[model samples]
Target: MKSDRPSHEDFPHFQTLNTRWMDNDLYGHINNVTYYAYFDTVVNRYLIDAGGLDIHSGPVIAYVVSSGCDYFRSAAYPQVLEIGLRVTKLGNSSVTYSLGVFAQGEEALLACGQFVHVFVDRARETPVPIPATLRAALEPLCAPG
Candidate 1:
């Protein structure tokens, strides 16, 4: 992997994620798949709390439409991670979130990934315009020109 690390300014929002002992694989480092979990947690937590998403009864919901990750360094247990976030794209009924995970206080990122969500009507399972509350909350995270 290249030694280049993205600057903190590259990301908009940030969250601290704890690495659990169980997150490590037999290989002795955090499994590649766990990074995706971290990505999901950071993005969903913001949506659920700030966007007012009722994971249970909300008439509208967002589902992961796609996701991917690129690892630059290994992350092991007992380490605290700072997950940076931002919206790469916001469409009529979908948003693509980009995330960068760094070892706490580190300027370089250990991994970077993206989560694309499609907002839909829970009952009809059809795409719907993004809710105003959700949009307002996500506005700040939207990528700048």
Candidate 2:
């Protein structure tokens, strides 16, 4: 179904990632699920650093409610992955992040997907407004696509 999709430049923002040895599958290429893991790491790492999110003791935390990906090309071990990231939408408690995975310096993506997270109070296990600091950090990445 995804074979007919257009190139990743069709989206916004770009973050590059590298493939590790452990990301490979029995078939010798990167496992499909590892792409999602990279997407999560890149997005969270940026948010934590830029947004000042404290995962251990922060009052606010984001929970992933849904995520998905589409493969356009095969990525193998020892390759540098360039992942493009952007906030497609920011709701009261939920944010939808779109990602495009490319190989090294390539301009096109090998995979793309959206990851949705619902911010919440970890103790109460319910949705909550995104913290001001986090919102401030994410503002730069929210420009319309």
Candidate 3:
């Protein structure tokens, strides 16, 4: 059952991640749970660095409302991975990010996934419109129709 995962070229942003020894399971491949961590890392790094998301002290913060992944192949410890990221949808208070994980320098995808984040007021935890600066930063990554 091979997954028709999206290719690396489908994404606009990329981050390289090195697999740790502990990431491997008894079968010698990286554990499935670790893939979710990679997804979270890339998304948060982009938000903090490019979108000016103040994780600690901001009027609004994004909370993950949903996430899912499809594995195409297995990856092992010590493999360098290129995590690809793109925005598939941008709504008033929610944004959906599509991601692909590939072996570094390879064209084939090892995994593909998506996660939805809903922005909300930090204090009240109520949904709020995405801030201007954050929206501006995410625009470039939006997938072309």
The digit string of per-residue lDDT tens for model 1 on 6-125 reads 557878889998999999999999999999899889988999888898889999998998999988889999999999999989999999998989999988778889889999999999
Ranked by lDDT, top first: 3, 1, 2
TM-score of each: 0.94, 0.89, 0.95
Point out where model 3 deviates above 4 Å: 1-4
Residue ranges of candidate 1 with Cα displaced over 4 Å: 1-5
Query: What lDDT is obtained when candidate 3 is compared to the true structure?
Result: 0.93
lDDT of 2 by residue, 1-145 (tens): 5544445554555566778899999999999999888988988988888899999999899988999998878999899887877887888888988888888767666888888999999899889999999988777777365
RMSD of each: 2.3, 2.8, 2.2
What lDDT does candidate 3 reach at residue 138?
97
Q: How far off is residue 144 in model 2, in Å?
A: 1.5
Model 3 over residues 1-89: C-alpha lDDT tens digits? 74445667789999999999999999999998899899999999999999999999999999999999988899998999999999999
